[model samples]
Target: MHVPDGFINAPVSVAAGVVAAGAVAVSLRGARKELDERAAPLAGLVAAFIFAVQMLNFPVAAGTSGHLLGGALAAILVGPYTGVLVIAVVLLMQGILFADGGLTALGVNITVMGVVTVVVAYALFRGLVLILPRTRRSVTVASFVAALVSVPASAAAFTLVYAIGGTTQVPLGKVLTAMVGVHTLIGIGEAAITMLTVGAVIAVRPDLVYGARGLTAPLKLRVNGELVDAAPARDFTPVAARSPKKVWIGGLVAALVLAGFVSFYASASPDGLEKVAADKGFDKNVEEHAAAGSPLADYGVEGIEAARLSGGLAGVIGVGATLAVGTGAFWLVRRRRTESAGAQV
Candidate 1:
């Protein structure tokens, strides 16, 4: 959920900003280990994909809807550190470009949505995967459960933040219940999206899906009429290796299609957080976004008359920008990793 400005006071918001900055800093360092030549750009695609899917809000309750949070999905597809960075990038893009999230509350949104969700989901997912069978199915199942819980965990995190710096007076108990309850329904949708996305990637490119990395056993061969495990193939490339460009192209196209066209059919109802805030009367403190004058504010082009065309153009622009920024960020991280290794020699 994108927290708007004025929902939280200045002091706590600044505190959360510090926390968000620290999280991003740590993730940048951690991502160095995770991103390689192939994975660096793919992680960027994950961010763009998350941005596109988030534009398609599915109905969760009669008056409420929810979209993919992408914490578990990204963490499973990529890794936990990169997942945090991915969500943070998406939130940053949405805030500055689309004016979806408030600039003042950017830290709050990142803290709750990006940091909390990734940490909780990844930890739980790893635990589950460790306890369950080491198969693709287990990875998918763990993804489902991890994603489902991450949403509520985010709700609880926001609640805790609000408790400390809420701008308006509201019943904390009711707010917590409503936030958690609606988000629980939202979590189901999150679970399905995460499960299906992870399953699809694992099915085609288990080598690329970070969570499914070790699931595949070593190739077996008949040696002297006896079945034996083959030697580790260092240069043995998987399906994704045949053409990494194709996968990136396919992913970008899917993201472009979803955000450009499919989002038009998405539910118009308020999302889980907005619904809860309105119901609890805490929306009263909401302030106008600082970037409300941006050309792409509210996911629509400023001068485009047709709602469909304007929205589609904005979505396309968003995807392209996110891809560029995310890819560049990861590329630099990868470059540093390479440089570090070279310096060791």
Candidate 2:
């Protein structure tokens, strides 16, 4: 949920702002270890894809809808550290470009949606991977569970933040109950999306998925009535650089369809967050977005005759901006990794 400026007191928001800044700083350093040549570019595409998927809000309840949060999906496709950075970039783009999330609430969103979801989901995913059978299917199963749990975990985090700095006098218990209850259903959708996407990528290029790395189980061979370790499969070298042409082009095309064409039929009702805020009276304090006057403020270009063209152009611009920013950040992380590797060599 994108908390607007007046939802939280200024002092608490400022404190969260500091924590968010420090988290990004630490994540930048950690990403150096996780990102490489193949992953760096994919990371950018992940951000753009997430930006796109979030626009397709699915119906969750009678009048409220929800969308994929993408933290678990990103972490499973890439790595946890880089996953955090990727979602952060997407959120940043949505905030500044589309006036979707509040600028002041950036820290809160990152803390709840980025750090909390990635940490919790990845920990659960790794734990499951270690205990389950060593197979690509296991990775897919773990991804499903990870995505299922991450959404409610994020809701709990937001509850905690509200407890700390909530400006409204709403009952905490009701808020928590509603938030978790609605988000659990949303989590199922998140799981399905993550599993399908991760499964597809792994099927095509398992080498690219960090969670699926080292998928081979230890080989058992009998030597003279004694079990002995069998020779391993050929060591997998990082695949040669090829254009991300297929996946990137497909993703861009899907994004265009969702935001450009399908969005016209998306429910006219407010999403879960807006519905909750209205029911709870927390929305009364939301100030107008600073970019409310921007041509793309409402996800449509001004003076455009056709809704399709206006929304399509805005989506294209969003995709371009998100990819540029995400790729630049990941490239920096990959460069750092290269430098560190050289120094050690």
- Judging by TM-score against the true structure, name the best candidate: 1
Per-residue C-alpha lDDT of model 2 across residues 178-283, encoded as one tens digit per residue: 8898889889988998999889887777778889888854568999999988997785653636555676667677766766667666666676667777888777
TM-score to native of every candidate shown:
0.94, 0.90
Weakest 10 consecutive residues of candidate 2 by summed lDDT: 235-244
State the lDDT of candidate 1 residue by residue for 43-62, as single tens digits.
99999999999999999887
Q: What lDDT does candidate 1 reach at residue 210?
A: 81
Off by over 4 Å in 2: 216-245
Kindly provide the TM-score of model 1 when superposed on the true structure, using C-alpha atoms: 0.94
Q: Itemize residue pairs with steric clashes in candidate 2.
A: none
* Model 1 bad stretches (over 4 Å): 217-242
Clashing pairs in 1: none
Q: Highest lDDT among the candidates is held by which one? A: 1
**Candidate 2 to native Cα RMSD, angstroms:** 4.0
